[model samples]
Structure formats: C-alpha cells, structure tokens
Target: MARLVARRGRWFIILPPLLFLFVFFLIPFAFALKISFGEAALRIPPFTDLFGRGADGHLHWQASLANYRYLLTDDVYVVAVLYSLRTAFFATLMCLMVGYPMAYAMARATKSTQNILMMVIILPFWTSFLLRVYALESIIRDNGLLNAVLLQLGLIDHPLRMMHTTFAIYLGIVYSYLPFMVLPLYATLEKLDRTLLEAASDLGGRPWRAFFDVTLPLSMPGVIAGSMLVFIPAIGEYVIPALLGGPDNLMIGRVLWDEFFGNHDWPVASAVAIAFLVLLAGPIAIHQYYQVRQVEY
Candidate 1:
C-alpha cells in the first residue's frame, strides 16, 4: 500500500507540468506543424485549408511539403541558420569566460561578501530587461554618452559608430545572459569541497594546477548547464539582434520574424521554426546521451 501511495504521489508531482506542457507547448507545436504543411493564402489565418470536402462528399486532405523544401533550398534561410548558430556559439563562450571568474571569486569570498556580491549580480533583474537593453543602446549610439566622453577626451575626431553592429549584438547578449551563466556556476562552485583543493596543494600542486586538475573537472556539470542556458536562448533571440544588429546580421530569429510579420508568410515562418527546433534538439539529445553514458561508465 505504501509503495502504491508513493507511486501515486510521484505521478501527482509530474502531472501538473506535463499538463502545462501539453496545453502550452505541444498544442501550439501541433498548430505550427499543421500550418507548415499549408499553402500561403490572401485570406484570414493567412494559410490555405489543410482539408476540404471532395466532389464525392468525402473528406480530402490538402497538404504540401513545399514550405520545408523552400527552407532547405533557400540560401537566405540557410545563411540565417548558420549565422545564428555562429553568433550563439560566440556569445556562450564569452559568457562562460566572464561568468566563471565572477562565480569563482564569489565562491571564494567570505559569507558576508558573498551575500553582497550575489545582490549585485541579481540587482539587474529588479529592472525591466527591455529597459536595460534600451539603456545599453543609448550608451553606444553615435551621439550617445560613450561617444561624447571619448570625443571630449580627444580620443577621436568623430563619434564612433558602435550601434547597429555585430559588436552591439554581442554586448547585448553577454550582458543580458551573464546572470544565467553565473548563477549555475556559483551553485556548483559553492558546493565544491574545499578539502579537495587543500589536498591537491598538500600534494605539491600549485594554485593554477590545483584549479585545472581539481576544480574544473568537478565543475563540468555547471559549465554544461550554464552553456546550454545561454546558447539556447541566444539562438532564438530576436529583440537584441533587431535593436542592435545591422542589415547583414541575418539570425534565424530575425528571418522567422520577417517571414511571419514582414512578408505575412505564416507557412514559411512555421517551417522555419520547426526546422530550427529540430536543429537544436539533435545536438542537445546527442549531448545528453553522451553525458548519461559517461556517468554510467
């Protein structure tokens, strides 16, 4: 009876989130998939019928795979996918480089200092994210504060063109996503046993050597977690790239947006989104399979 009750309790905990995903994620994905197989139309809902009544009064399905085919053959969309992946990769790398040091410093600090540092790290969340991005935009604009200060200091004769560039996009991503990287790293580093580092030192390992041999290997979980958090969202990012990137910056998110809203091509947009999900899911699934295998070994 106790075992049965525990099994029921486990299902009770799992049921809510499963229901939520079904309603919110799976249902929407079904609609998107249905739409992707539709033809573009000038009328309401913007896509042609998926099914119709035939002359014999029998239901007939009218689905097309042309949208997916177009996505595959189009150089524009292919370039957007590649560029989005490249930008997300670099952004994740930057976040890891910056966040790891900050996390390590916080982990090594005294309790009081750690609390203060954590507050500083989280303070950005108090304000609106859009507002923060806008503030960054203001600072980097041609006639903005950064250029004004540099011009005043005689560092340049003209205001530097910083906004609407790849640099701006990278800056926005790193700034916005830094907290995601740091928190996981801090969680892992904080729980790490200090005795291991001490033992390494006792065995004649230098500080850097101890860190490389002891600390890094132990923190692999956090590193992977943080990288995934940053990379996944960065790939689908639309606002930062929209606000900060140039016309040449063709991220997949931007391409999706332009297809849906700019061109009002819902079928193409749905196809892009479905293809993007498949592209992301493949790597993540492979990574998880390898991680499980490593743990078992």
Candidate 2:
C-alpha cells in the first residue's frame, strides 16, 4: 500500500509538466503538421481543411503533399536552410571555443570568486534579450561607441562597416548564446573530480596532456548539452538575423517569415516550419543518446 501510494505521489508530481507538454508542444505540433498537408485557399483560415462534407453528401478526407514536395524542389528553401545550418554550426563552434575556457576559469576559481564570476555571467539575463542585441548595435554600428573610440585613438581613418553584415550576425549569436554554453560547461567542470587530475599529475602527466585525455573526455556531456542549447535556437533565430544581417544573409527563419507573411502561402510556411522542427530533432536525439550513454558508463 505504501509503495502504491508513493508511485501515485510520483505521478502527481509529474502530471502537470506532462499535461503542459501535451497541451502546448504536442497540440501545436499537430496543428502545424495538419496544416503542412493543406493547400492555401481563399477562405477565413486561408488553408484547405483535411475533412469536409462533399457535394455527394459524404464526408471526405482531403490532404496534399504539394508543400513538402515543393520544399524539395525549391532552390530558395535549400539555400536558406543551408545558410542557417552553416551559420548555426560556426556560431556554436565559436561559443564552445570561448565558453570552455571561461567555464574552466570559473571552475578553477576560489568559492567567493566563483560566485562573483557566476554573477557576472548571469547579469545579462536580467535585461531583455532583444534589448541586449540592440545595445550591441551601439557598440558595433557606424558612429557608435566602438567606431568613435577607434577614431579617437586613430586606429582607422574611417568608420568600418560593422552593422548589417554577416560578421554582425555571427557576433550577435555568439554574444547572446555564450552564457548558455558557459553555464553548462561550468556545471560539469565544477563537479569534476580534481583527485583524478592530481592522480594524473602524480604519474608525471603534463597539464595539457591530462586536460586533453581526462578533462575533455569527462566534459563531453556538458559540451554536447551547451552545443545543443546554442545550436537549436540559433538556427531558428529570426529577430537577430533580420535586424543585424543583410539581404545576402538569408536564413531559414527569414524564408519562413517571407513565405508566411510576404507570400501569404500558409501551407508552404507550415511545411517549412515542420521540416525545421524535424531537422532540429536530430541534434536533440543525439544529445539524449549521449546522456544515456554517460549515465550507463
């Protein structure tokens, strides 16, 4: 009776989150999936229904795979998707490279110092994300603080073209997402067994060698977690790219927006979004697989 009661109690604790996921994520996904198979129509919802009563006085199912088919055939879709992927991959790489060292330093710091550094890392989150990106504009834009300072210092005769460039997009992604990478890495590094490193040192292993062989391998889970955290959202990022990037820097998010609002092609937009979600799931699945393996080991 106690065991059964405990089981029910556990489920009671879990039920709200399960219900939330079902209501929010799953339900919306179902709607999008249904719409992906729809055709754009001159109606209220602007898309054809999956089920309707026909003129023959019978209920009929209607669906079209034309949107998905068009996705494969469209050069714009392919180019946008490829660009988004490339941008996300490089941005994730940059975040990881910069964050790993910062996280390592934080982990190595004394407890009070660690607290200060952690606060510094987290302070940006207190401000609005969009506002932070806008703030970056003040530093990077022409006649902004950075260019002003550089001019004052005689570093360059002219204000460099910083805004509305691919470099700005990359900078935006890295700046915004760096904390996400650092936090996970710091968590993993903090909980690491220092005794193992000491053991390796006692065996006359070099610091760099120990880091490569022991620390890096042990920290793989955190690396993967932080990577996914940055990569997934960065790929689907609309606001930053739309604001910072030029016309040439077309991402999938922009493509989706133009398809939905610019072209008013609801079915194709739904298909693109669904396809994007499916693409994102691959990384998520890989992360879960590694997490399970880590737990098993």
Candidate 3:
C-alpha cells in the first residue's frame, strides 16, 4: 500500500503537466486541425462547420484537400511563401556571418571580458522588444542617422529610403535574432578543445588552415543549432515584416495574418497555417536529423 501510494504521489505530480499540455497545447492543435478542413465563412459562426455525410448515413469527418489546392494555385500566397523563404534564408546567413566572429571573440576573451561581452549581447534584450524595434525604426528611417551621415559625406544627395523596405526587414531580423545565434555558437565554440588546434598548428597547419580543417568542422553542431533556432521561428514572423517590409514584400506570416484577422477567413487561415507547416517540414526535418547526429556523437 505504501509503495502504491508513493507511485500514486509521483503520478499526481506528473499528471498535471501532462494534462496541462494535453489541454492547452494538444487540444488546440486538434481544434485547429479540424478548422483547417471545416467549411468556413468569413467573420461568421459556423466559423468552421463540420462536414455532413451522404444518404448512407455515415459520418464523414474527412476534410477536403481543396484548401491545400487553393493555396497552391493562389499567386499571392505563392509569392508570399517565396518571400518568406528568401527573407529567412538571408537572415540566417547574415546572423551566422556576424555571430560566428563575435561568438569566437567572446569565447577567446579573458574571463571578465567574456562576462562583459556576454552582458553586452544580452543588454539589448533587457529592453522591451517592441520598443527596441521602434528604436531600430529611428535609426534606419530616411532621415535616420545612417542617411544623415551618408548625406553629410556626400554619398547621396538626399535621404535614402530605409525604414520600409526589404533591406530594413533584413536589418530587423538580424538585429532581433543575432543574440540567439551568438549565444549558442559561443557555448559550443567555447567548449572546443584548444589543444587540438595548437597540435594541428605544431604539425605545420597554418592558422587559416587549422581553422578550416579543424575548428570549422567541430563547430558544425553549433552552426546547425543556431541556424535552426533563428530560421524556424523566423519563417513565421509577422512583427518584423509588418514593421519593416514594404507593400511589395509580402511574407507568409503577413498573408496568414491577413486571412485570419483581415479577411476573417478562419478556415483559409488555418489552411495557410498548415501549408506553412508543410513548407517548414523540410528544414525542420534536416534540423532534427542533425540533432540526432549530435546526440549520437
């Protein structure tokens, strides 16, 4: 009875979290899945209506795949998907380029310097995220400091368009997600075996060669991890696009938002969401594979 009581006590602790996940997470997901296939009206109850069966009197819970087909055929959605993919790709690349060197420098710093550098990276995050984005707008606007400097230097005759464009979007993405890349890359690179590089150098490998031949390969796990971290949520990002993207640079997140909130088409919105998930499956699968490889090693 005591043993059973202990097991029951453990279950009591475990069940709450599991139940919480099921109720808050899984149930909503299942509901969304239902919404994806349901017959829907724009801004109406029957917000999503369940399908009915034919004369045989059988229940047909199967959702029509027409929503998926519609998304594929829609030119706007297609273009948005492409834009989202392109933005995310460039953002990830820029983050890696900027983050790798910074992370390496921080990792190689003296203990106190490392702490200071880490704090510097974290300092931006201490502010409200929306406010920081607003600050970026101030910095990158046509009359912003960058344009003022360029104009003063005679680089341009007029203040350049900077606030609302694809470039601004890229700038925002890099600024927002750079720390995510740096922190993980720093963690991995810091733990790297320095003696191995030293040994490689002693064995006649030059510094550049040693880095390419030794350090880079070893840091692959961190690169993959950080890239995945930045890339995944980035594809679904709405805030940065809304803030920085021009009218022409329609990204998937914006499209999803338009469907859900603007057009009030919950079924189509859910379908768009499903399509986004499908598009993301490739990168996610690759990330998962790399994670498995990391685990194996």
CA lDDT, every prediction? 0.91, 0.93, 0.87
lDDT, candidate 1, equals 0.91
Error of 3 at 137 (Å): 0.9
| Local accuracy of candidate 3 as per-residue lDDT tens digits, 1-297 | 999999889988999999999999878867777788876664456464576675799876556777777888889999998888889999999999999999999889998999899999988868777787778998889888898899999999989998779999989989998988999899999999999999999999999999999999999888988999899978889888888788887889999998877877787888888778878998899889987887898
Per-prediction TM-score, please?
0.90, 0.92, 0.90
Which candidate leads in lDDT?
2
For every candidate in turn, the CA RMSD to the true structure comes to 3.0, 2.2, 2.8
Tell me how far the alpha carbon of residue 172 in candidate 3 is from the true structure, in angstroms, after superposition.
Answer: 0.8
lDDT of 3: 0.87
Give the residue spans of candidate 2 off by over 4 A: 1-12, 289-297
Candidate number of the best TM-score: 2
**TM-score of candidate 1 versus the correct structure, residues matched by position:** 0.90
